[model samples]
Target chain A: MDKLTPPVSGSRYSVIRAIIITWMTLVILGAFLLDIPRMNILEHTARNLYFHVPMWFTMMSMVLVSGIYSARHLASGSRITDIRARESARVAAVFGVMGLITGILWAKFTWYSGTSVWWNSDPRQSMAAIQLLIYGAYFFLRTTIDDNEKRGRIAAVYNLIAAATVPFLLYVLPRQMESLHPGADGNPAFSEITAPIMRAVFYPAVIGFIAIAWLLYRQRVRVAILKENLTSD
Target chain B: MRLHSGRTSWLRATVSVFLKDTRIEWRSRFGINLLVLFVLSSVFILVFALGQDTVERNVIAALYWIVIIFAATSSLGRSFISEEEGGTVLLLQTHVPGSAVFAGKLLFNLVLILIANVLASLAFTVFINATIANWPIFVVIVVLGSSGLAGATTILAAIIARTGNGGSLLPVLLLPILMPLLLSVVHAMIAALEPGSSWNDVGNDIATLVAYAGTVVTASVLLFDFVWKD
Candidate 1:
């Protein structure tokens, strides 16, 4: 709860960073090393359940964090809140792109093996791509304005507007259409299908990925604040 | 004048703004002309590009909505930019509440988009021989989808009006936000075109369209003050 103005170094921060790094390393090792129940097409690629799925969970968390910061920025008109919002969204966009690239690779070898189709227009995949576009638009809107305060206010407004549409775009519309992903069209969701052994790694992967996103966001916020301080002084 | 007035006056101000915009547009015919020309050109291009091949209902539905969306994007950004260009933004800001201004512009844009959509669909029918199997659901989708598009874009137009390249930024900002509504409407249109499809078939799409419109419009009203008062 200490002031994050100079969040560059602290014992607690270093401790948490150490833990996260060690934790993610274990998750990645377990992802490949663990023996998972195999299915016909999913096969060994089923281990992707640890890496690929967590990217989305982490991205979604970043979205929620960015949106909360955007709302707080609007309420308080504070540069700190604006910085948090922008940085969190930056992390969110990074995770979103990573999620997309991993999804394509995973889908290529498993679902479309031996075919030239990397993009099959799955509803969930398409929605993720659109979500990334929304983030792009948010960043693009920021660039169009010159005044820092004006940019913060207007970009905050736009970030909130775009976030408001995410639920419908990512969840509602995609559920209506058939998709290759699970949890669609009465297919068993992850919980129903995943063995309990896999859940051990899966849950921690989600946490580890989200924690990484948080660290990235914090780093960006600190850097931006320092830059602003240097420029204004 | 009280900045925060009773509901009656707020409604009156909203209507007055709508009427003023309507009167100006009536005289200038800019919005209508741009929309009509865009719709006609896109439909002509589709006809030429599509040729005599019988296209699937899904593709036709997609084309129909795509044309309408592009026409809207091309024309709707001008609503607030025109006010800025004429230097009436200050005059209007001094006179009306931001919420009322947004509502009025939303109403005007809704009407404009509705007209454009109807015109585009009619062109689809005439040029490509498209036919609607279910009139009731198709009309509902059109009304709800147009309102959703208008509601979402009106505030964006206001936001971009102050920026340097408002014209180019509108679609980039708009299309991503409009994707869900567009997909739902296109889905509903495809259902409506299927020979045996009924309201039951398009129920989710209708609900999505209505929800999309409600969410965007409500969010815009609450947020327009931030965008407008600056």
Candidate 2:
């Protein structure tokens, strides 16, 4: 394989801008077209699929990135790699919270009492809450340590260990517990017909969210580097 | 002075560390007393919250497990804090292998939890009239369940000791990881406690608890080197 050249950093903004615009257009168009189907569940609640599923997709994607970066840092002992890992975790947390909020809203509208509270022992809800708690502990662990090197190493190790548990908690354990969530047998959320339509907008939504989160991550890293530089000088 | 070498020396080191920790704890009286008091208070509070109504045995069994779990949290949190606060952990780290250190601490914790479990079980029996038809199975569940708890908590407490908000953050980090262990223990305990309930009823749960404990112990042993290095 030929060695790849890095893109010119400043010129990359045009690509990002195009991606953003394309995502917004597709989202607007998808919402407009979803009405043609007239499937009862897909009529009103289907709109949420575009937003909610993508949030979860992005969150999982970012978490995988975090784990990859963490493993890289552990193997290489690179500070930049550790920073990237930490930033991925932070971005994943943001998307995770969004996924959870959207899910609860969808639950209220679709499954819960139309007029009253709708909290039940649903496995999906329970496991989602547990996932949030696990990552919340991740951030808590990061902040509570004082030494930067120790913090990075500890958090990276923890990220990897905790990531291993997520699959079991989110998928395996819930199935064992017999959740009320649809698609336990096989989640129709990702069925062939729906999935194709989902991918039409979802792929871009994913790219868009990652780009947005990357931009934020870069900004935060720059600020942090500046603070360190100023303090040293 | 150079520490002793060889497998016999390692065993001796393990025993010494275990006895030293137990002796220090006995002298301090803080950990054991606090654990005992916390266990008693939690049982009383749970009993009061649940009330004396003849609720379904399953619900009672569930509630019983929750109380035991929360009580375990208190003792588990204390297991490492005392070492850290007194600087014993730093000294211990210098003298023992990571696996041996984990082993000694785990043994100490398992014994402490066993004592607490007995007291809590008695309190549960008196409060809920909980009847265990199979004493042997009941004992086995308690032993396996608490061993699982001790293994998981030892690793978590080690992690938490390095954190600033060690007290509060410990439970947040621990409880989620402990869920499967907690569920298995509760299921096994319910099977052992409920009238006419058989060991076969919780066979899967017991097997799971055994697997969880073995997996956690192995993982912690493998990971402790990385964890302790920093």
**Per-prediction interface RMSD?**
1.1, 2.2
Off by over 4 Å in 1: A1-4, B1-8
Clashing pairs in 1: none
Tens digit of lDDT per residue, candidate 1, span B4-56?
Answer: 34444788889888999999999999889999999999999999999999989
Error of 1 at B109 (Å): 0.7
lDDT of 1 at A72: 94
Score chain B of each candidate by TM-score. 0.96, 0.91
For model 1, residues A46-153, the per-residue Cα lDDT tens digits are 888888888999888888988998899889988899889999889988988998888999999898999999997878788778889988999999999988778888
TM of chain B vs. native, candidate 2: 0.91
Look at candidate 2 and tell me the lDDT of residue B208: 77
DockQ of each: 0.72, 0.47
Q: After best superposition, candidate 2 residue B136: deviation in angstroms?
A: 4.6
Q: Which stretches of model 2 miss by more than 4 angstroms?
A: A1-8, A113-115, A170-172, A175-182, A185-189, A192-199, A202-233, B1-9, B134-137
The most accurate candidate by DockQ is 1
How would the docking of model 2 be graded?
Answer: acceptable
TM-score of each: 0.94, 0.86
Query: Which 10 residues in a row give candidate 2 chain B its minimum summed lDDT?
Result: B1-10
Clashes of 1: 0
